[model samples]
Target: MDEYRAVALGTSFMMLSTTSFIGMGDIVTKKSLDWVLSNPKIGNSLSILGRLMDDMKSHKFKQKRGHIASAVECYMKEYSATEEETIIELRKQVNKAWKDINEEWINLTTIPMPLRLRTESCTYQ
Candidate 1:
């Protein structure tokens, strides 16, 4: 899919997974006050991956009966790609998101270590 739609889907899916952040353990600490609480790309990657995978599995069944449009729909509409191509590209996105999360784990962040562990636990659950 096109770059713009890909980013939009990721970000939208991130927002859609807001429940996943409920266990972020609050981020008003000095290090992780604003950006960590507000715009956490590393954690968002997990949500994006989950959303894309879910959409890939459920889109065809849902769309056939005129349910909500998914990331698959957006990609197909934006890039004129077939379902197989869209799913393949989405799988690539999911893989890249996992890599991003892995990289985030390897690097130290401004985020506090304890809250990081909580975020990890939240995702794992």
Candidate 2:
């Protein structure tokens, strides 16, 4: 009988501990969700802008590479001196744009999540 009683008590304790942990987790998740939802606009805008910038940079790089290839082909055909200069300029522009975009991404990541949320909320309101 004593052994059975001990088993029941242990089981009860285990159940309570599990329940408490789950409840605490739920509370924390709810709080975080509420915070994010409250400032949807600023957060959403930043995310959208970041994605747009990424797409634009990718497109620009592809276009620049295509132009460089065309210029190289022209140079091969005619040995035109200006073709090499054009290729160099295209490469420089692409590299500079890539560097600037990378720097912007780094700066964006530095913003605190909470502050971003706050800004988003203020913007919407």
Write candidate 2's Cα lDDT for 1-125 as tens digits.
23322332233322322233343333334444444445333343443333333333454465567632233343334545564464564455446645654454456543445443343333222
Which candidate number would show the highest lDDT if scored against the true structure? 1
Candidate 2: residue 29 lDDT (0-100) = 49
lDDT tens digits by residue: candidate 1, 1-125? 45544654445433433444455555535455454446577767867766788888898898899987788998888889998898898999999999998998888477667656656655544
Query: Considering summed lDDT, which 10 consecutive residues are worst modelled in model 1?
Result: 12-21
For model 2, which pairs clash?
42-120
Score candidate 1 by TM-score against the native. 0.68
lDDT of each: 0.69, 0.40
For residue 40, model 2's alpha carbon misses the true position, in angstroms, by 0.4
